[model samples]
Target: MSLLDFLRRRGSAPVARERLQVLLAYERANRGYSDLLAVLREEIVAVIARHITIDRDCVAIKMDRGDTVSTLEIDIEIPHKAGALLVGT
Candidate 1:
């Protein structure tokens, strides 16, 4: 089965399980939580930039409390590549 099908079948998995593990690994590597946040933001922007043009100022990332744990939240503002304004007025 495809990855989506696997994920759908594993719908009982707790949210943020993977992200929490990542954050814990970052901490073990002597990286502060804030530092991890910055790295995550940059990586997310880079990944999204590969698919679309994005406004850097409109990019935001943070950790929020999930129903059972903390979850990483990513927000990106992508514009149409063709003649799209770089900034909103």
Candidate 2:
């Protein structure tokens, strides 16, 4: 592959990060709890960061509200091979 192709593939990280940020922002704005979610997300990421280095911008936290229950979804991208070890594969 050409250098251009390699560079193009590597560019996806920023794009994904921005998309996740936008999505999380939209979710927070719609359902409220913006402050609580922000703190919750940071705390969760900090705990994970203790063991593995991660990009803060790449973390995505989503909250879904249902009729009877609420759901909190978090997506963290591990940028290295260490993730496999974490999963105990």
Candidate 3:
């Protein structure tokens, strides 16, 4: 396939837009958005630190509250492949 065709095909792949939308809805429904975010951040950092070293300054956790629910938005900055650490983190 041509480069353009390959790029287009890759871009056309189905995205997790629905999952994100659901998460947003869930977040909005939850109260205490900031408190929840703080708790999530602490948990995430604690979980990450258990396995590897992470730059605390780079760690970020946010809550996106939609019109109905609140969703936990976790943003982590790690230096290695430790995706599994985030499972319970």
The CA lDDT of each predicted structure is 0.71, 0.85, 0.71
- Model 3's alpha-carbon lDDT is 0.71
How high a TM-score does candidate 3 get? 0.46
lDDT of 3 by residue, 1-89 (tens): 99998888786535567667776666677746637657767888998788888888788776565667657667777765565565646
Q: Can you write out model 2's per-residue Cα lDDT over 14-68, one digit (the tens) per residue?
A: 9999888877866767676648889988999999899888899989999886646
What 10-residue stretch in candidate 1 is worst by lDDT?
80-89
Please name the candidate that would achieve the greatest lDDT relative to the true structure.
2
Q: Model 1 reaches what TM-score against the true structure?
A: 0.48
Give lDDT tens digits, candidate 1, residues 1-89: 99998988787455568778866775677645557778888888887777667787788887775556878878776666522645433
The estimated TM-scores of all candidates read 0.48, 0.57, 0.46
Model 2: ten consecutive residues of lowest lDDT: 25-34
Q: Tell how far residue 61 is off in model 3, in angstroms.
A: 0.9
> Quick one: ranking by lDDT, best first?
2, 1, 3
Runs of candidate 3 with Cα error greater than 4 angstroms are 1-34, 80-89
